[model samples]
Structures are given as structure tokens and as C-alpha cells.
Target: MARKLTPAERLATAEKDLLLEEIADQSSWDQFLVEQAVFHFGQRHDEWSCNDLRDVLPELGHGFLGAAINSLRGAGIIAHTGRTVPSTQASTHGHRIGVWRITGKGRAIAAQRRIARARGRAA
Candidate 1:
């Protein structure tokens, strides 16, 4: 008689199948990276300042990071606490000293992307 698989074995097999499905669903790398960044920032949502984000992604030069931040804000993925400050170069500085906090939608998207990546790895 054939023996049935153990509970652990069955779970592992199911997990592997689920992972494959997730990998197949991912569209591109940019989507993956954005999801990752959002997720990373979401973890420390309360402490994430624009400077903190820049530090986390040092490769994203200031201009690029600024654009990304704007994009996130526009997409409603992040929001500011509504505080502002004047800079040394008040004439040229229009940006505020805002702290970024990820929205619930952002967190959910990030979590979905992470799950997809994890599933891909399992596959």
C-alpha cells in the first residue's frame, strides 16, 4: 500500500506550489523594488523622515529621491504630518521638514509584493 505524505511534507508541497503562483504574477523589477521600499519604510512608519528614506536608498541621488517621494505622496502611498520649517536658503526652499508615514494601502501593496517574492523563492 502507498503511504500518505506526512503533515509537514504536505504543507511544504503546498507552500512550494503557492510560491510558484506568486512568482508568475509579478510583472517587473521596478514594481518589486517600489514594493520593497514601501514595505521597509512601513516597518518604521513613525520614524521615517525623507532624510531617513534617502539614507536607506543612498544610490537614489537627492533629485531622484525627491521625485520618488513626490510620486509616493501623489499616489497616496505616503502622507506628511502637516508641519513645516524654513531653510537657510528660504528663497529657494519650498519643501517642508515633513516626516513620511506609509498609508494602509501602501502597507497592503508592500505586503502583497513581499508575499509574491517569497512565493517566487519557494518555487
Candidate 2:
């Protein structure tokens, strides 16, 4: 037999569902962080090594970082330079690392997002 929920219980259940939805959206938030990182690199006009990004965003797991960067590359948001730098991590045994640069499209997207963010903050 199913029990009926009181009004207060229904409200609590709705809030719980909302919280769960927010939690599920965290992946999107992390993706946004990855985009922001690439945008920052583009704005600086500097090629960013994977290790560099990892260092800057230590809170993001290595797997997530790799996947995020891969997603960006696949989406044409970032391109890899031929130049390789030594990995900052101790685990690398003389293996070179690829450097990433944001593409023109990425730059334009970043700029637009920056302006939007500024406007949002002002509002």
C-alpha cells in the first residue's frame, strides 16, 4: 500500500528532487570550468600544457581533466601544438607532453562569454 504525502512532506520531496537535479548538473559545471581554463589560456596567448592546467586546477581529477581537454579538442575549441614539453608530474619517464592552444573560434566564444559574464555580474 502506498502512503500519501502531507503538504509539508511533498514540499520536502520537491526540494530534495531539486537538490538532486543540481547535483546532477555538477558535471556541466565542471565542463564550464574546463572551458574557462581554456579561455584563460587563449586570452594569455600561451600554449598550456596538460600539467600546467592540472597544476592550476588541482581540484579537478586527472581523468576529468584529460576528458575535458579531449572534449575541447574534439569540438575544435582547442588545438594541440606540435611542440612538447616535459610533464611536470614525477610519473612521466622522459615522455614529452603536448601543448594546447585555443583556436580563433574558441577565442571569439571566450570573448563573448566574458562580456556576458561581466553583464551578468553588473546586473
Candidate 3:
């Protein structure tokens, strides 16, 4: 007789399927980077700097965060609010900063990621 699959095994299979689906649906690397920036920014809807995103998403190449931010802006996934110097840079950079926040579309993408993660966990 065939053995029944364990709950953990089932979950792993489900997660793998979901990951494959995501990979197939995702666009190019630049697009993924832009989406990631939007999703992360959505978590902190408040304005964030390029460095902030870079720190959180190390997978992104150096200066790639800025490119992602620009791409997101073009896609209307994020918008610039203004800039402020963080405490760390207030002295050296003289408070030179650029602020950005996610848009409605960005929120939608973030919601999708949450749903995907939930589905993965449920499986």
C-alpha cells in the first residue's frame, strides 16, 4: 500500500508550487527589484530613503535601489514626498535626503505578497 504524505510534506510541496508560480509570473530582474521596493515601502507607508531600501534589500546591487526607486516612480508604484536628513547623516550629509512612499498600486502588490505568503504557510 502507498504511504500517506505527512502534513509537513504536503506543505512543502504547496510552497514549492506557489514559488514556481511566482517565478513564472514575475517579470525581469529590474521589475522584480522595483516590485520589491514597493512592497517593502508599503510596510512603512511613511517616506523612506533609498539607503533604507538598500539596507533592507541587500539582494539589490549597489545603486540599484535608486534605479528601482526610479522605476517604481515611473510605474506609479511609488512617489517622492520630500527629503529629510536622518540622525546618522544629519551632520555629514547636511541633512540631504530624498523621501519616497508607496502608491495605491504598490499597496496592491504588497497585498498580493501577503496573500501568497499566507497561502504558502497554509499549505
Candidate 4:
């Protein structure tokens, strides 16, 4: 058995999800490109957060980096470093975001991708 959401809570959830989708769509880069950019970014740094990633990525609207980061996290490509830093965006008002690092599995996969990419180029 589960408690149902109140009408107000449901509406808030819908609105928040809508805003998230809108921000994700606003990016000039598509979802795969966004994911790829962040994935490769992890290879170059030991630990990073959206604040650092923002410097490398293109204009992604508000909080647009989250979906891509979450995707990688879900796939076990990265893991939280058990650290956090205040978000630079004024909208977040200094709230914290997790710092993350690539895992061994992630590094192995990245290496495979690099080899495949180089082979593709050589062909």
C-alpha cells in the first residue's frame, strides 16, 4: 500500500518535470551529445561537479546538466566522491551539488570507446 499524492503535490511534480524537460530540450546539443560531452569530461579530470562541467559544455539553460549526469550515474559510469560544493548558479543560491569521479568500470569503458574511435578514424 502507498499513499497517493495530494492534488497540489501532483501539480507541483508535473510542473517541475515539465520545466526539466523544457530546459533539456532548450540545449542546442541533443541528449546523446550532452551525455558524450560529460562522459569524456570525466576522463580528463579526477573529480568534477556540474559547476566545473558547465565551463566545458555549451549553453544548456538552467540545470540542464543534471539529466546527463544522472544518466551516467545510473549506468554506473560515475559515482559520488562523497563530497559537495555550492552551486554557482544564482537560482540555486549556493545549494550544494555532489562531486563525482569515474569508477574503474567507467575508465575501462572509456578506453574501449577511445580505441573504437581511433579505429574508426583510421578506417
Candidate 5:
């Protein structure tokens, strides 16, 4: 079983997430989320819906998430896996929502961005 987070650790994580969101630009934040989603959703075996992502990234505004989803879809970075899952949002309790998975192209782009970020920090 996974260890539970201590209160202090949870607080620190929340602070860090907030600070990162504030510092990052929209595109950068979106890209970061795309990479994060790969891990968050279990890659190819699992998929995430909008609400799922929202739950994981509460710091991101709805408008930002919507735009990011569209942009990634357009760029072929993410695609609907032709699957639908029950909505997790309270407002849409019974509705089915689209499921998305990262594409190979998306993974490639994410990898490149991750490398660039690492290099930037190193420099």
C-alpha cells in the first residue's frame, strides 16, 4: 500500500503546485500537464476525461483546461480513445465523458519538452 501523505507534505505540495502554475505560461503549463497526464492516467492502459484531469490539477482554470485539450487534440498530441466514462463532476453526475490517451507524437513532444526543461535547469 502507498504511504499516506503527512499534513506538512500535503501543504508543501499544494504550495509548490500553486507556485508552479503561477510561474508557468499557458502553453508551458499545458505541455507540462500533457506529460503529467501520461503518468496520472497510467499511459496507454488507462485514459483520462476532463473531470479526471481537473481533479488532478485543481489549480488550472476550466478555460485553460478546455483550450489546452483542444490544442493538444489539434496537434495530435492526444486523441479520444473512442471511450466514455461516467462523469465525476457533480454537475454532470450521470453524463458520459470522452476518454483520451496520449499519442506517440504526444509522448515524443513531451519527452522533448522534458529534456529541454532539464537542460534549462542545468544551465
Candidate 6:
């Protein structure tokens, strides 16, 4: 069993959730990032990190992609793969970063989106 969150921790969690929702609502970037990360990298590889995501996503500013990825994980779209690797960014001095993989839920949603896109194009 895990320790329950304190009031401050709970408040911080709520604040973060609201901010992530606002970021998603403000533009299409969040959805695009999901597609690019889930379909692009998630399809070709079994595991990835923000390094891989940042490589493909040109629009998100520093820290934004990390936030988005956290949101995705919260939504059950991706999960830690029980692996870690040194970040390729020289700025990090090879710090360890978590590896992640798309969850079944993520793959299902991607398939549904693909079908919808196909139908839209057909129509």
C-alpha cells in the first residue's frame, strides 16, 4: 500500500491536471503530439523516451513535451517499460531517463482514429 497524498500534494496534483487540460484545449498541438508519438514512434519501436519524442515534435517548446507525455501516461495512453537509458542530450550529461511504451488503450485509440480518418477521407 502506498502512502496517501497530503493536502498540499493533492492540491498540486489538481493544479497540474487543470493546466494540462488547458494546454490540450488551447490548441491542436497536444493531439498532434499524441499522434506523432503514438503512431510514428510507437509503431516503429517498442520503447521510447522524450528524446525520441522531441526529435519528431518540432512545435512543442522545452518542457511542454514532457508535460504532455505525463498527461498521456495519466490518461493510460503510455506506460513505463521498466527500463531506463541515459539521455542523449549533452545538456543532461547523460542522466538516466525512463523508457516508455504505448499501452493497449493507446493502440486502440490510434486504430479508432485511423479508421475515422479513413472514413472522413472517403466521405
Evaluate all candidate structures by whole-model CA lDDT and list the values in order. Answer: 0.53, 0.63, 0.57, 0.69, 0.59, 0.63
Instruction: Give the worst 10-residue stretch by lDDT in candidate 1.
Output: 5-14
| RMSD vs true structure, all candidates | 12.2, 11.1, 11.0, 11.3, 12.1, 9.5
**RMSD to native, candidate 2:** 11.1
Per-model TM-score versus the true fold:
0.53, 0.66, 0.54, 0.70, 0.56, 0.65
Worst 10 residues of 4 by lDDT: 7-16
Candidate 5: lDDT over CA atoms?
A: 0.59
Tens digits of per-residue lDDT for model 1, 1-123: 446433223222323333545545544334334434644675566646655655565454434555555666766667776765433234546565666677776666556656867878898
Better of 3 and 5 by TM-score: 5
lDDT of 2 by residue, 1-123 (tens): 446433223222312223545645554556545654655665686688877777777576555677667767776777898888988777777588888898876766666666766766798
Off by over 4 Å in 1: 1-39, 84-95
> Model 1 misses residue 80 by how many Å?
1.4
The clash number for model 1 is: 1
The TM-score, computed over Cα atoms with residue i paired to residue i, of candidate 5 is: 0.56
Query: Once superposed on the true structure, which residue ranges of model 3 sit more than 4 Å away at CA?
Result: 1-31, 34-38, 57-60, 84-95
Give the C-alpha lDDT of model 3: 0.57
Where's the lowest-lDDT run of ten residues in candidate 6? 7-16
Which scores greater on TM-score, model 1 or model 3?
3
lDDT of 3 at 92: 48
Q: Candidate 2 — what's its lDDT?
A: 0.63
Model 1 RMSD in Å is: 12.2
Clashing pairs in 2: none
> In terms of lDDT, which candidate is strongest?
4
Pairs of colliding residues, candidate 1: 19-119
Model 4 alpha-carbon miss at residue 5, Å? 32
- TM-score pick, better of 1 and 5: 5
Candidate 5 lDDT, 1-123, residue by residue in tens: 556433223222423344665537343565445544533353444567887777666564554666666665765667889988887777776698788887776666546556766766798
Please report the candidate that would top TM-score against the real structure: 4
TM-score: model 3 vs. ground truth: 0.54
